[model samples]
Target chain A: MKEMFLIIIFIVASLLGYRVIKEVPSLLHTPLMSGTNAISGVTILGSLVSTAYAVSSGSKFLGFIAVVLATVNLVGGFVVTDRMLKMFKS
Target chain B: MIGTYEIVSIVLSILVLVGIKLMSSPKTAVQGNRIGAMAMLAAVIVVLAYNGIIDVPLLWFAIFVGGVTGYIMAMRVKMIQMPQMVALLNGLGGGASALVALVEIFERYKQMTLFGRLTGQLALAVGAVTFSGSLIAAAKLDRRISQRPIILKNHGLISNAVLLIIILLIITASVANISGIGFIAIITAFLALAYGVLFAIRVGGADMPITISLLNSFSGLAGAICGFTIEDPLLVAVGAIVGASGLILTQIMCGAMNRSLVDILSGSQLNSGINKKET
Candidate 1:
């Protein structure tokens, strides 16, 4: 039952995302990609939860690394996108 | 029945959607990015509180180090380096997903349901591929590697064989006993990494935009699949949205290049006589 609910959320989100992203002008494609790229860092949530729950030391270490990498992807992606968008402003 | 966590997650997902919606115009793009970042911050806080991990100093430290590094890299990168920077970040995201899935497999394989096992293995494979593929794409774009397509003899045959092996390994790992699952998962990651390199190495420089976009989508799909393994609604929804956004961008890039996604993936366009003039 939970899996099905998640599947539905995935489908609905994808459809809406396609519709919304389609409206972005071609000129902003780079920023658009970078912005969405940052959003993919959503995995950090998974990393944090998994790391906290991790039983083994190795698993905890891996999860820690995952957290760091995901955070970097998130922060770097958004900042870069913002920089690019600022270029257009000036 | 839905709980408070679910409700909050839904609201946060909506906020993220609105953030993306605001990116359609230049005037609102910076604001949109800020909103997206704010939503991400909130999501992290909520997840930490809900999971009762808010006090984990190590996790906080990890975030601090990663945040500082990411900000410095973003500020230092030149405009001409944007594509590779994005590619590098995509690789990191995918690598993180792969690691999370791998750890999950190690930590919970015995207790996990069949569905969890399957999704976990799939996430590992996709994430591994995205990680390596994006790195290669980044290197190529940055001229760290040859920009020309590195088409080895029977490249298509080799890539197909590696993919088939990955599928078989995923299935095997999903059903394997706990004692053997870890080994199988490691082999699967290695093979998937190889496939990623092979897949990205054959695309010429002219096809990089589409390649990067497609890998961007894979990173999201990897995260979404990881969400299923871990049963997180917010991760699933946000990952799917990112996946869809990347797909849209890939489609736009393909259209702009007058090339089909299939051609780019299969490397057929690289060898076609008529298309040779454009590249």
Candidate 2:
């Protein structure tokens, strides 16, 4: 089933990521957290699709809120991660 | 199952994955982040164009407002406050995913098959938990709430009981086609939200980073479930990558702190004052 396939991919991805992240130093933990937050903002795509297809005013309103919240997550996450990384370099 | 647009979207999402992987390294992190963001933008545009929705002024306006808020906060917040900010962003992401699932459920719950309804419920429960839980984590990090493990007498028992109730309600809501089931589902959601707050607040400050990462993974899982509800493979891929990245970060953090995930979750040092405030 599709769900099972996705679950399998999830495990593989987690193991692969763990292999990579384990090499990172403790000094970068904050930046790593912020950076992953930025990537998770990818949910914005789903919000956009939902907002477009929403028919009723209520659904549209929820979709709109979702869009805005997701945008905040995406933009803020990236900018903050950048700032944190900048600190590391300087 | 295979369309040009889907192929393009999948390819772009893979780039996002590659970007995130690159970000684990210090030398290319910023560029990697930019690559990921660009891929998201590209995928969004492709999906929008394919769906034939080119002009939605309200959507653009919402994005503009959100962009300004995010820009200002990211620029103004101090470095020490990054953890709380990350937690807040994670909460927002989770809340957004839940809202999407709720909208879909409201629009089509009556027509959806059991599988569809189950996916919706999964999205709703996980999303609500991540949203509220991440906020509590942020609050603790910001010192708005006590940073120590907040152990109410019989806390574990209460959480377990509530979780059992939620499971029962979710099953009923998913199987029964009555209006009352909707109400039950709503109450279940709020209870799950409260549980999220309780779960996060019980951890000590020293473990806040791991909690944030774990919550990030929860939000990603919520998003993936939301994708299944909407039948979007791109969303699934993006969510999986974020979820995996969060889990990896959490493991690394736990290892660095010399604690296991189980220890952090169980409030291992709850009343003994073993984890003194880290200055």
Candidate 3:
């Protein structure tokens, strides 16, 4: 039942998110993408928390994986975002 | 001895260094984007290799699965759909955090200690709220529902009051090891989700990037709370990284957009005077 609820949550959220983001115009995508990249980077903190909460030694391994994925997303996203914005500057 | 997040971080760092070295030398923006993604993937690859758990055949199979999916999506999807993809994926992060919290709640149920009970409830509440709230925000942004403002006067003030009352009650009851109020905590989550949606809808389309960013931060905080509830040091650290970075990004987004956090939260044009008037 718990797993079912979690699945439901993801499905609903995904559908809704898809709808909302679709409304954004294509011309604005670059700026929106750059901006949301920062938003997506929130995954870093999520990874950290999950990593920190890992109770078992085995869980630590998984936690570390999550943290690394998130950190990459955060830093890489930011640098790329800055570069993208710079294109608009010239 | 090894896991995904650590490897991803190291790979990302190396990519950053390589990127810096190449910076002044000049490159196409498209090339930069491609390299950045490769950096992310490179980290993912290292973690998988370092773990050394999956067999060779499985590793090849996993890569094939992910690659095929990405290729198909890229080939078929319209460029216009990218933002929706962003929202959908970000929603996954938020929803995932909430689910982790749910598991932690069950863990506490088994032990039922003092701080365990309090932290458990808090984690659960935050998770539930993020799960629903992120959904609503994404829905509003995607225009899946009517984009019109669903206005209620004094919403922020009322929400603050109600949430405060609930917290006080919970804090008082927490010492007694109250187990039954978990349902109320769940209800609070429903309210948070609803209010967050309503809040997101009231803001103009121009404001959404920050809204999405802020919600992303909220998800991180939820994960952090989950980490605490589970008593895992690594989870806590990772969660904190998400929470802090999300917060920093939110601040940067707000600065770029010239909106104050307070205005974004309590003073939506439709919400009508939650704060006292200056005059």
Model number with the top lDDT: 1
Write down the TM-score for model 1: 0.96
Candidate 2 CAPRI level:
medium
DockQ winner between 1 and 2, please give it.
1
User: What are the lDDT figures for the candidates, one per model?
Assistant: 0.90, 0.80, 0.47
Error of 2 at A25 (Å): 1.6
Candidate 1 positional error at B206, Å: 2.1
TM-score of 3: 0.57
Off by over 4 Å in 1: B268-279
| Candidate 3 structure quality by residue, lDDT tens digits, B1-279 | 234553454345444323322321233334444454555455445434444533544334434543454345434534344444344445545554544444444334546555555665665555445545556655666778555445568766766665675566546545765466545555655655554555555554445656666666566556545545545323343344345444555665555555676666543542332243221
TM-score quality measure for candidate 2? 0.92
Give the chain A TM-score for each candidate: 0.93, 0.82, 0.62
Off by over 4 Å in 3: A1-90, B1-77, B110-112, B165-173, B179-185, B267-279
Better of 1 and 2 by TM-score: 1
Ranking by DockQ: 1, 2, 3
Candidate 1's docking class is high
CA lDDT, candidate 1, residue B154: 97
Compute the lDDT of residue A20 as modeled in candidate 1.
74
DockQ of each: 0.82, 0.63, 0.07
Question: What residue pairs are clashing in model 2?
Answer: none
